[model samples]
Target: MKAFLPPTSYEYVTVHKVQGDDVREASDVLAAEEPLEIRVGYGPVGQREHRTISITMRTPGHDFELVAGFLLTEGIIRSRADLQGVLYCPDVQKEEERENVVRAELSPAAALDLPRLERHFYTSSSCGVCGKTSIEAVHAAGCPRLPPGGVRVPASVIHQLPERQRAAQELFEQTGGLHAAALFSPTGELRLLREDVGRHNALDKAIGAALFQDLLPLHEAVLLVSGRASFELVQKAAVAGIPVMAAVGAPSSLAVSAARNFGLTLCGFVRQQRFNIYCHEWRIS
Candidate 1:
């Protein structure tokens, strides 16, 4: 049987559509965005401790995958073995808020680094040299430099990715406001795809799905994002061991720097059958 999934889009809002003096009232579909509180349950059998980890604004579907990907990319839980289970918070009294919260139970053997986690959240919320500092911290967190020559893709394949990803975006076709992240085989076959109002959240859901399937260290995969590449997105891809990342839009300067530092192949403006390889060009054939 297919698993039950939550709704990812909403259509309750009515809007006025005016085009060339042709105005009419129409119902519109929107990519659902809601706050998800991620809680972690840790410690030994009889001395378990539960703590709220983060609350992020995200689309409603794939909540479990989002939590798993967030934990992995944040350097919280290392692997699937570190996770005991992920479930909705049943104690939430209001029915509507029940699915809005999720808990990831950690194995007793999994070490909890509260200080590092706290520092991560702080840096994320701050400005200034946080970009440079965050990149350095990723190094400090033991995100390995991607090994050289393990994966390669053709420029022809890269050229076709954006269109393929867009075609698979069911929610985006309806709302036209969702960002997407997808994992593809080196040969350009789409493996997993996720959509969200937040770019990073979409990536987390995709990576989280891979994690649940024990597909981490995605050394042979190509990651494609529907929007511009950012530092956070690059960092998350590097942490997940994705070798090559391509974006339909431009990449920030810091994103290029991080990709170079992490030895990841970064591609930007991947449309019109052409793209710019910001770093690690050898990965593209």
Candidate 2:
């Protein structure tokens, strides 16, 4: 998986003189692929059997957190108790995909309104807006307000992030295709970073990493995206209890609205030593 997901930064390649002749090889970076499935189940009574709800194409790592994050953001599941376990599925059909994708099975007690998911998504990854069609739907998502306590982040801290984030991106620098997500403490020490070709995948990887490390209920940390923050990113961060969401690029209008609705601290255009805090300014120390 590490081979699939390299550091976000690029490396300098030194070409030998080769008797003054030019080299003929190209550095082609590969895209990462993995399996992610969402499942549900009943409690520890009776068969307590689980059921398969959804399966998604994804990169190979962070299978569990991706499940948890996906369920929370999709409004299917909430809290630690809502989940039984999100692990690699031994489902035999998985071999059919180009690569073996993992699945997350939930307890039988958990019910997923598939129509809710189906109505919003026509194709995978193409439909970024499902379950969030109307403003009323947004209201139903239940993040109507973000962190009640004032959280503040400093502009100086944001100005220095792009460089620091770049320093850790070994793969993106080499491949020129991956997006990155880095988690930093309030004081600004980077805790974890994940990179992938998809902006959403990058975030999924970061959240997955955090979950793998037992870093849940992440109210105290700040999440930084290498690119612009999107509505899905805001939704994911909000559900994960991430109070601050920052981006190196511009955020969509929906993202701003979602941030405000969820009481999330949304910041964008985080370069040139300047940034804009679109919502929850109190947290920008």
Score each candidate by Cα lDDT: 0.89, 0.68
Per-residue lDDT over 1-285 for candidate 1, one digit per residue giving the tens place of the 0 to 100 score: 112335644455899999998999999888788889999999999999999989999989889999999998888888899999999999997877878999999999999999876654523634556567878888877688999889989999999999899998888887899899999999999999998899999999999999999998899999999999998899899999999999999999889999999999999999998899999999999
Number of clashes found in candidate 2: 33
Using lDDT as the measure, which candidate wins? 1
- Where in model 1 is the C-alpha error above 4 Å? 1-5, 120-125
Per-model TM-score, in order, reads: 0.95, 0.77
Pairs in steric clash, model 1: none
Could you give candidate 2's per-residue lDDT for residues 72-116 as a string of tens digits?
A: 666676555566666555655645542243455455566656676
> What TM-score does prediction 2 earn?
0.77
